[model samples]
Target: MTYDPTNTPAWKRLLTIETMFKEGNERDRLAREAAATAASFPRVIARYLTDAGKALGDKALAVTVTETGPRDDEGRSAFTVGNCTVCPAATTEFWETAIYGGYESDVRLTVTEAAQGAEQVVRRWAEAHATRCRELPVEG
Candidate 1:
């Protein structure tokens, strides 16, 4: 039979279907673009520990970078670099490596006594993870 949609319910149904497909395609495109942008640029977190030249045994330093968008199940934005704790050795000039926990994974560097460039290493790790991680944080 020939399909006709003049003043009929099929017209509305067709319109609805079209709209759904269009919206879905647009959403996919947006997601792709967001992923590309994220891969291209790493998030920036200020270096407070090394920049200030704080002495060893001072207060522990934490460097975190929260995602700007895309909330989690708890309606909170994810942390690309979260819970990064850098503690200075009590009796040594070296700074302890940072332990970082994020939405995607947790990393603990083996370099306990990072004598030089410890802050830079931690910062680079955070920035690198921030660029690649897209998962949202989950409340645990």
Candidate 2:
């Protein structure tokens, strides 16, 4: 299955722009220090998804990302692959590596902990993706 961050909703794109932070002064710090550039956000997401797709293999990729849409929880939408969600937990569902940020932000999510096996892969990919995101220097 093919992956495209552009397929993500508009709301999630906005959230993705701001969700990367440590809050308080760190938000300010990131705004100033992480000034990596913004045009690459979608490219970054697409690259991460591509790499993850390869790592997990074709069958797993086909059954998950390409075949499904983000699921809604309450008023929020969650982007899922297999049984795990990978979206920001507010507004609308969109592709995101925001597995942990939802817990910190006011956004509410359905799942948090990373389990064993496949779930573990999803969890670790999110963590790594989040770290790589630090390179983007997104402006809040």
Candidate 3:
């Protein structure tokens, strides 16, 4: 356990701080992520699928490499889905901002790795899922 002054008891905090600062054994890896923020969060890598026909629930799926940092400054990306009831019955419409894409959080990966992982998830999910909206047969 880290002994952050603010997070630990008065005595343990100082001791932990001394141990970390003096020995550098438990130094938190905050330096690497200092500049990272929600607004400035470099995506590193991502995968996307444009709805074009609004077939997918949300125009596209935002398959992105997940990283924890900064804060929830952006709140959350707005998302929407297409109406499936109409299918071939009538025209349907929907709007969305960002779609859900499974994240790889176990290990921090290089940009290339992140991109590959993201695309893999996007493709897998997109292929596995089915679209309810279908075109009706044209009259001969």
- The clash numbers for all candidates, in the given order, read 0, 1, 0
Q: Which structure among the candidates has the greatest lDDT?
A: 1
lDDT of each: 0.41, 0.35, 0.35
Candidate 2 lDDT by residue in tens digits, 22-137: 36568787556434432222121221332334554532221122112222223222343332123231111233334334333444333332111223444455445533322221
Per-residue CA lDDT of model 3 for 1-140, tens digit only, reads 77666655887878887887966633444433444444564332323333323544553332222322222323333211221222322111111111122342544444434444444544444332323224332337
Candidate 2: what lDDT? Answer: 0.35
**Pairs in steric clash, model 1:** none
Estimate, for each residue in 41-102, the C-alpha lDDT of model 1 and write its tens digit: 43444433322123343333433532332221122222333333343211111222222322
**TM-scores for candidates 1 onward, in order:** 0.31, 0.18, 0.23
Mark the regions of model 2 whose C-alpha exceeds 4 Å error after superposition: 1-115, 135-140
Which sections of candidate 3 miss by over 4 Å? 1-105, 130-140
Question: Considering TM-score, where higher is better, how would the candidates rank from best to worst?
Answer: 1, 3, 2
Candidate 3 C-alpha error for residue 112, in Å? 0.7
lDDT-based ranking: 1, 3, 2
